[model samples]
Structure formats: C-alpha cells, structure tokens
Target: MTAATVLVVALGEVRSPVLESVTLARTLGTPVLLSLQPLSEADTDALGRAGVARALVADLGEARHAPAVAGRAVATAAEATGATVVLLPTSFVAKEAAAHAAFLLDAGLLVDVATLRLESGELVGGKRVFAGTWETECAVTSPVAVATVRANAIVAADAPEAVTTAVEPLSVDATLPRGLVLDEHEEHPRAEGRPALAEAAVVVAGGRGTEGDFAAVEELADALGAAIGTTRDCVDEGWQPHDAQIGQTGVTIAPRLYIGAGISGAPHHHGGMQASGTIVAVNVDPDAPLVQIADLAVIGDLQEILPAAAQAIREHRES
Candidate 1:
C-alpha cells in the first residue's frame, strides 16, 4: 500500500500554529508536504527543522491575500502531492480557504479541530460544538480530508535531525472571481512585540469591568509577553478594536493560558474560550458566570488586582 501523504498549508508569516500543524503531520507517519508562498532563508531553515519533507511554493502575487486564490493554490498543491489529508491553521482566511479546498477536493471538512488522529486508517478530528458545550469526534469518510486546526492543540517539536527539504514550484490559477479586483490592503497595527491574539499561547483579556480603561490588562499582558483580547462590550464601547473581541460573534481562541478581567463569563463569551487549557478570571462579582468555570478565580476589583499581579510577575522574573 502506498504511504499516506499529509499536506500542511500556511500563508504569510510562519506562526506557531503552522509549526504545530507540521508537527502533527509528522506524527501521522506520512510524507509531509508544505504548501506556502515563497519563503525566506529563515523560513526555509525553520521548516527543515520542523521536518518538512517537501515544500511546494506558489507565487500567487497580490492574489495571495485573497482566500479564494489561496484556496485554489492549496487544492492544486494537494493534487500534485497526492495528499489524502490537509491541515490548515485556524484563521479567518484559513477557514475560507478550507471551505474552498474541500469543495474542490470533494473532501470532508472540519473546523476548529482541537485534536486529530488516525483511526483505522481514517482521519478523525475532535472539536467542540454548540457554543463549546459539546465535544464530538468526526471521521472523514471521503477519499480526502481537510481540517482547520486551532492553535495550541498540539505542541510543536523539532525533528530528531534536520533534513534537507526539497523545494518545488507550484502553479496556481491566480484569476480573481467575477466582480473581484485587487485593491489596496492594510495590515492591522498590533502592539509592538505582542503576539497575535488568535495564535498566542497566553492571552490576557479585559471586559466592561475595566470601565473602558485597559491599562491594567495591557500592563499584565505586556509583562507576561501575552496577547491582548477584549470582550464584545469593550469593542462596542471603542475600548478595543473588533479584532480583539473574543465571543461567539467574534474570534474563537483556545490558548494554553487565558486570563480574563472584569468579564461576566456570559455564555457567548465562554463559548469562545472554554477550550483554553487554563482559565483565570478576576472579577469583583463572585457570582459571575466566568468565575464559576475558571480554574482559578479571584474576587476583586481588576483595577487593583491586575496591576498587583503584573508587578509580582515582573518582580519574580527580575529576581
């Protein structure tokens, strides 16, 4: 029997989740093929250390920013590599691309996958559903499987020894869809040195309890080298941008460590972060829903607690 091949698709700057996908692919005992844009020397070296057997580089140009175009490239690479399973890092663009690839490949598509394994020669993904209250396992019955994986789902580890990754150019149809045209795009400005919220292993979030001032939250996040997130209420209040909101209507994250301040732990918000490996909640309301589910709960005013916590962390590191 021919060995199964797994394709990991990553776009733009390589992130931790992308490395995790590569690690998972290696764990599958399959020939791992990486489909991505042209890489720099650093990225190429990094992938080699991560155990990529081969890389398929597609020059999508401006179309690289478009999910539909990237999806086409992913599909093309999968076909060329004879990949039976495709893994993608969970992001807005990746989710869209997964849909497009699944449609083109006639594969079973799974999103927000937190665990993946091969069961009886079939790819099975474990994910949470119904606002993070239910866990289910889905096995792909189709010839091919495509899944978008959440960050921190798997720990990234280096290969036993670095191997030279053969690089091959992949051709993709860069034509835009009808009525779509390339336009100027602007990347959202993030705090210097802070990780992206969606992919960060540690996240510190604020809510309306901060009363529109995120100073405490920011300090703590900075001290911990963590990403900053906010509740929907904070976004509506203009305390933070929409991209920072974490809720059912906003971004879903499953970081290793999540610290929430002044959050009520509403079902909508909990649903988004319930998958976090560890949850710490700081709020004045002892009865807050978030406090109930938190692995560690502190009943106090965040304005006072956050700064103190940040200071203690900084002092410990310095000491």
Candidate 2:
C-alpha cells in the first residue's frame, strides 16, 4: 500500500531541519502529523507556518532526556495516527530514538538519508556509504519505515496558505529503562550570534595549522554568517570545543558551503563533510589532502588568507 500518513518527530525547541522534514512530508501526498514533546505556543505558530494540520504533543516530564522514552512516545503517535512513515532530523538523540522506534514497530530504519522518495508503494532512501566514497539506495521492506534525515537534504519552504494545526495530547506509558536513572542534568549556555554548526548552511572550519589561534577563522565565519567547526586535532589541542569538532567521532554535517583551513583531510574528517554541496580548502601545503579533494584550493597561510577574505566580504556587503 502507498504511504497513507507521515509522522515528523521533533524536540520541543523546533529546529530548522525539523521544518525541512515537514516540507518533505508534504510532498509525499500523505497526511502529516507532527510529534513534539512539551509543545509550546511558538511551536504551534511554527507548525502553522509549515502547514502542519495536526500535532501529537507529549509531556515526558523528567524522562524527556531518555531516548527510549522519546522513541516509545513516537511509536505511540505513529500508531495512533496510522503513520506508515516516520521522519526525524539526524542527531545523536534522534538516531537512538529512531532505532528504538523502529525496533518497537518492527519497521525498517534508515539513518542519515540524503534523499527520500516513494517508489512502487515503498519508501526508498539514498545515502552515501563507505566514508562517502559510494552512493547507494535502500528500500524499506517492512510495513512501516523510520528514517533519520541529514541536514541540507532538502530546503525548507513555507506553505502557500496558513493552517491552524489541531493539537492532541499523547500519553506514553514508557519510562526510563530499568537501572537507568537521571540524577541530575545541566544545560549549557549556547554561543550567541552564530547558527548551530550541524544546521548551518555555510561552515568555516580550522585545523592544526591554526596553531591554537582561531581568531581569523572566527572572523571569517562571522563575516559570512557561517558556523565555526574544527578538526579533531584542534579540539584535542584545546583550540576549540568538542562540539565544534566535525569527523567520524564527532558530528557529521552537509552544509551548502564548507571552507576548510589548515586541514589535512584525514579520512575520518572527510567522512563527516564529504557530502557538502561545495568544499573550499585553504592551506599552506600545496599537496594537502583537503586541497586535493576541494572544489577550490587556495595555497596560502590561512591567517593571511582568512583575514583578507573576511575583509573583502565585509567590503562587498557594505558597498
């Protein structure tokens, strides 16, 4: 049978990729239901803007941080709405939740899918594999499909007309698994005036060549309104935070534009960013691996090149 209904699961704090998933769901020609934990008025407004007609709001209380709990809630919503496909944004928590939801529903799971389509009444997904060296398509054979979609997979669009979403409260019986307890939790303050690294359209990253100095990289990132990322070496050297590190061991990004400075493009690092729409490499070494694979290679000291590029961008914007 064709996909009759689609479910898009997101956190209480709406993310851009969640909206993009909603936009993608609309194209499936199915009834789309949003599942949010601790829904808020802002979320409802955003849903209306995204053209969502219904939402399943769950109040997970203290168990909100538990992926299993979230996953159970998602499964319940999918069952209640008769959703054949469940879509979520790719994140650490979302990945775990998707896996758990798929297990509960006995559905096929796809992670970090770059594109999705309906073919012959089946959900098909395209993804890169083997460290982004090869592309492959996967079709879900189960009755239900759960997929965690990557960022920049689809551009978010606003609806042609406004919609008032009908909100429904979902009750989840699932709780924290046995022997697992959340004693305390701490929320970190987010960096201001910059977009989230995982969701940024443009990313400016530095590496060992920065010499523990990220001033130039920061300036260039700010000039282009881009997020700042760093290689594992930079994070290990304390030049950047662990959250800023992009690699197999850290976060994977698929920004529209990625600029690498002083990076050697190790396989681990390449796996994280190889899906970027365009890559530009700036390094002093003419034969750096990043330069070799970059769409544009600039041979120069990043300290000099970055500042000059930032200056040019600022000047052009003012002119």
The C-alpha RMSD in Å for every predicted model, in order, reads 1.7, 1.6
Residue 26 error for model 1, in Å?
0.9
Provide the overall lDDT of each model, using Cα atoms, as 2-decimal numbers. 0.87, 0.87
lDDT of 1 at 68: 86
Worst 10 residues of 1 by lDDT: 27-36
Model 1, span 154-239: residue lDDT tens: 89888888878888888789898898887877789779989998999999999999999899999999999999998888898898
Q: Cα deviation in Å at residue 70, candidate 2?
A: 0.7
User: Tens-digit lDDT track for model 2 on 1-319?
Assistant: 3677889998547768888888888877554655546667887888888888888878787676678888888889889889989999888888998998999999999999988889998899999987778999999988899999898888988788769988888888856889988788665555676778888889999999999999999999999989999999998888898999999998889999999999999988999999899999999998999999999999999999999999999999999
- Alpha-carbon TM-score of each model against the true structure: 0.95, 0.95
Q: Return the TM-score for candidate 2, rounded to 2 decimals.
A: 0.95
Compared with the true structure, model 1 gives a TM-score of 0.95
